[model samples]
Target: MTIPTARTTAPFDAVLCDLDDVIRLFDATEVTRLERAAGLPVGSTAASAFGPGRGGPLVLGQLSKDAWAESTARGLADRVPAARARELAAAFARAPFRTDPEVVELLRAARARCPVWIVTNGTPWLDEDLATLDLDGLADGIVNSARLGVAKPDPGILLHAAGRAGAAPERCLFVDDRAANVEAAAALGMATVHFRTAADLRPALAPLLARPVPHPRR
Candidate 1:
């Protein structure tokens, strides 16, 4: 709930990035994949157990991998086994990076000016996804929620990621698609950009990143 002081003109020393919906692509692609693999459309089962009409909250760190499995089984009336649901969820562990070349290029360009580390609410699967995108060269280090057992909006994970990235929390610039995550990072004294699109971030990052940018819609 605390707002960060952005009165400082100096640039932050590091960038802590979020993974899902911020750095990588996420969709219901896995639901179909699990359906084909399991010989049934298992989406509804997972949907019902998460208190109905909920997707993002149930999927992204809100429901643990185990909770997802168990809840899914109960929802499907034994049509989908907990073990199989877990397998399906695990299979969905990675989503490919968006093919937005500008985003990728901008990340590279930004990192040259300052160190960039991925600070995400995720399992070890983030490494696998980055590997899938062949971006080992792009990243310096990663902070995963599964390893830390805490998700963002919690300053602990942010501080931990920043510390490991050789940057202070106050000196890190963070990018995330979620407003809550952005606010959380900002509370820790990191500059935040709510990335709606690559173009939308330019204005927020213009002063911090040395680049020509068209004014973005906040």
Candidate 2:
């Protein structure tokens, strides 16, 4: 979908972007393989780690990553050996989460034009994972939900990200793969791009970057 150019005269002051499925791509197949190797059913690992009352608290920063890992292991131990379960958890955590080189270049370009911040929902280990993907240095800042106690689709996190970028909510552009998140940001008066692919992203960001920066009042 085409993102319309900003109707206002002032260019966006910051760009807030999502991480998973946007900058870095997760491999579900690898996760499934790990689950099978651990003797758990397909999709079991996801259900145990990401379903309600499981990894949710971890993602919200209420539970420690170690605790979350232990919990996931326990859930898998019902079908596999405890040692195997723990191994599976560790392997999943260390899985190769890769970043799209094109997206990285785009992020760098966007940062040159305006402040860029990573606004993502993730556990405490997210920083470590981003570092592995060589994406930790691409943004001016990061607003992780685990540390902030809120996730996207909640306007609060989006506003918080704008604040971290030192920009008003209306002067920030939020890009995410989730429509719910894009809608939520739009509802809070932030310009949004529902990113799908590199093709969609380039056009969406073109007009924003082309607009002249707003001059400070004398």
Candidate 3:
């Protein structure tokens, strides 16, 4: 299907982008507060919740809210009783449950430059949000963690996305706000850009996007 996309001058072959902090309003501060309320040990945060001490990795399969809840439980085991795990998970789940128009526009611009592929870590319900955002034309394809049974930083998940984009790991450029995920992609031979803000992304992405090269290759 022809996915709808806005035109832009970004340069690239294939775009494998992330959703959370990159497109939506994901508040680390809020996650920290929830972690504290749940009674996790000091310095225990959402991402770190699934760190080594807990389970191997918090895998969230598409459509399984239970996976999200379990990951939350593992992260805050000391503070969160089993009964409250799902509820707490639901709260954070609401963040990326919606889309930002401005971010969507940026994605459109990027999409126009080349095939756009989304690879985000979210629950099963995220498909609804992705559809609401219109996946078909907006992305050449998608590789959400929920559907793939793996989350970021895992080579399998990254490789899974690389296959969907039809681009070798080295040819696809990955953009994620997390340093670790970006580093992980780099390890797989894909170029990566750590997203600090939309503006911060331009310089790093300019050369990789499909938009008219601002200057001829030297």
Candidate 4:
């Protein structure tokens, strides 16, 4: 599908973007590797760590990082020693978080034009994760689900992100790798871009950057 462009008439005052699969890449292979190394079957780590019963509370701020790690370790204790499970959990928590230079450049350009906010459904260590990628200063603001006690596909976090950008929901442009999140923002009257790659993102954001910023009323 073609990338959707922002409306030129109203124009967006800010950009709200997702973290994983957009700014930072999450390696599924690494998770599988960790699972195997821990003597569990493939996908076991992901299922136990991110699956409904375990990771839901972590993402929603109900569980602390240590608690989530301990929970994940417990889930693996049958296959691996409890100590090894904890080690695996630590490795998973410290998984490679790399930033795309192209996306970073694009975000920097976008930030220069208007406010840019990182709106992500992440764990309790969201800030630490961003710091690892040197992405802490890239955006004007960050709204993490783990910290907010809400997540996307729920309009509250989107509205909260826009508020953090100091822009009204309708005046913000939201970009996410997930279709559900894009649709959720669009439902709230915000312009949405379903981001697939950096190439697609540039064109989607070009019009917003090219448009003249509206002056404040005297």
Strongest candidate by TM-score: 4
Q: Which regions of candidate 3 deviate over 4 angstroms?
A: 1-11, 27-63, 66-90, 95-97, 132-137, 208-218
Backbone clashes, each candidate: 0, 0, 15, 0
**What is the alpha-carbon lDDT of model 2 when measured against the actual structure?**
0.80
Give lDDT tens digits, candidate 2, residues 5-87: 85645467789999888899866777778777666678777666775676668768887777777787777778888887887
User: Model 3: per-residue lDDT, tens digit, 48-152?
Assistant: 344663233334643344565566555555556765555555555554434555556666766666667888876567667666654445566667676677888
lDDT of candidate 3 vs native?
A: 0.66
Higher-lDDT candidate of 2 and 3: 2
Point out where model 1 deviates above 4 Å. 1-10, 29-99, 211-218
Cα RMSD, each candidate: 8.3, 6.0, 8.0, 6.4
Best by lDDT: 4
User: Ten consecutive residues with minimal summed lDDT in candidate 4?
Assistant: 209-218
TM-scores of all predicted structures: 0.66, 0.80, 0.66, 0.80
Whichever of 1 and 4 has more lDDT, that candidate is: 4
Worst 10 residues of 3 by lDDT: 209-218
Residue 199 local lDDT, model 4:
86
Q: Which residue pairs in candidate 4 have backbone atoms (N, alpha carbon, C) closer than 3 angstroms, thus clashing?
A: none
